[model samples]
Target: MHRFANPAQFNRLADAILPWATGAFVLLLGAGLYYAFFDSPPDYQQGESVRVMYIHVPAAWMAMFTYMVMAVASFTALVWRHPLALLAGRAAAPIGAVFTALALITGMLWGKPMWGTYWVWDGRLTSVLVLLFLYLGYMALWQAIDEEEKAGRAASILALVGVVNIPIIKFSVDWWSTLHQPASVMRLDGPTIDGSMLMPLLLMAGAYQAYFAVVFLWRMKLEINRRKLAVARQVSMHAPVGAE
Candidate 1:
């Protein structure tokens, strides 16, 4: 891990991996969408509307997965003062926020057709709503501070604090009486879903993971470049007049 601490090494590694990651994302996403729309059978109860599960489940997984990534990065940044770790956490914020929004929106679309309502105050729903706010608050905290180090510290602290909510979101249905269904795919008894539906769901989940990798690498590279430029400008400003 420390080998990647050097910005130059990290940039080279990111460049090498990005093409493959992007290709995997595109391929998996296309295949997943095809299966979801055409190959996968409709639910016995929900009928055609069940197709939305492919998108909604994957987006929901990515939302939580991205937050976990950010929180882990934040922990590393805080504990080891790893520059790349801080940049990774910072870069992941917007991506996680976007995924969280997609989850909420797709969930509402699914909910409306099945539950006869677009929104509900169920434990799972409310916890996910809090997650969205947490994402926004994390980003807002970063932007609110002027200094980079200070911002990183503040955001990292908030991220660690907010991670407690992740378990709450995952187990809300089990822990409380809610409209949300209990775990189907991830349970002690294994997935209760059919193979036809599970395949597309897993495919879409892989696609979303690949997409996150591609985006996160791009953002991390951009952050590194931006920091380098800032340092260069600061050095120039402090240099003697006419000094190169």
Candidate 2:
């Protein structure tokens, strides 16, 4: 980990991995979509409307998964003072926000057909909404402060505090009576979903993970370059007029 701490080394590593990541993302996404739309059987109860689950479930998973990544990165930045950690947290914010929004939108679309309403105050729904707001607030904190280090510290703290919301989101379905369905795939008894549906679901999840990785690395690289440019300008401003 420390060996890749140098920006130049990290950039080289990113460049090497990016092409393969992008290729895998495209392949997996294509395969997942094919299975989701063409191969997977519809739910016995929900019928055609169940197809929306392919998108909604994976987005919800990634929404929480991305936050966990950000929180871990924040912890690293705060404790170990890892220079890239804060940048990673910042990079993940927008991606997580987008995934959260997708989850909400897809949930609404899925709900209208099954639940007779597009929106609900269900515990899981409300908690996931709160998770979305946390992502927005985390990103806003970074933009609100001008100093990079100060913003990173503030954002890191907020992220750490927001980590509490994750469990609330996860367990809300079990803890409260809600319109949302309880865990089928992750239950102690074993997955209730058929293998036909589960295969596509897992594939879509892989695609989403790959997509996040590619976008995250790109964002981190851009942030690092932006900081380097800022430092260069600051040095120039402080240099003697005739200095080379």
Candidate 3:
């Protein structure tokens, strides 16, 4: 882990991985979409609307997953004082926020078809909404603070604090009476979803994960370069007027 702490090393690693991640994302997404729309059978109850689950579920999963990544990175930043860790947390925020929004929107689309309403105050729905807010708050905290270290510290604290929301989002259906469906694919015993539908779902999930990696690596590299540029500017400003 520490071997990759050096920005140059991390950047080289990222460059190596980016192409693979991008290719995987493209392949998986194509396969997932083919299976989702063309191959898989529709739900008996929900029929065509069930297709939304492919997008909604993966987005929701990524939302939580990205937050977990951010929180862990935040913990690493806070404890190890690694600039890479802090940059990682910062890089993940916007991605997580976008995924959260996609989940919410797709959930609402699915809800209207199945539940006969576009909005609900259900436990799962509400908890997911809160998760979105937490993402936004975390990003806003980063933007609100000017100093990189101070912003990283503040945002990292918020991220760690928001870690509690992940479980609540996961278990909201079981914890409270809600219209939201309970876990099917993630059961302790095994996934209950039929193999036909499961293949596409899993493919989509892989695509999402790959997409995240590609974007995250890009963002981390960008953040690192931006920080370097900022440091260069600071050094130039502080240098004697006639000195190099």
lDDT of 2 by residue, 1-244 (tens): 2324587788999999999889989998999999999999987777977788888899999999999999999999999988888888998999999999999999988887777788866666778888999999999999999999889989999999999756766577446643345542222123388999988888899999999989999999998888788777887899898896
Instruction: Write candidate 3's Cα lDDT for 127-153 as tens digits.
Output: 888899999999889999999999999
Q: What is the lDDT of residue 166 in candidate 3?
A: 63
Displacement of the residue 127 alpha carbon in candidate 1, Å: 0.9
Regions more than 4 Å wrong, model 1: 1-5, 168-191
TM-score of each: 0.89, 0.89, 0.89
Q: Kindly state the number of residue pairs that clash in model 2.
A: 0
Candidate 2: RMSD over Cα atoms? 3.9
Candidate 1 residue 215 Cα shift, in angstroms, is 0.6
List the pairs of residues colliding in candidate 1.
none
Give all candidates' CA lDDT scores. Answer: 0.85, 0.85, 0.87
- TM-score of candidate 3 against the unseen true structure: 0.89
* Model 2 TM-score (2 dp): 0.89
Maximum-lDDT candidate: 3
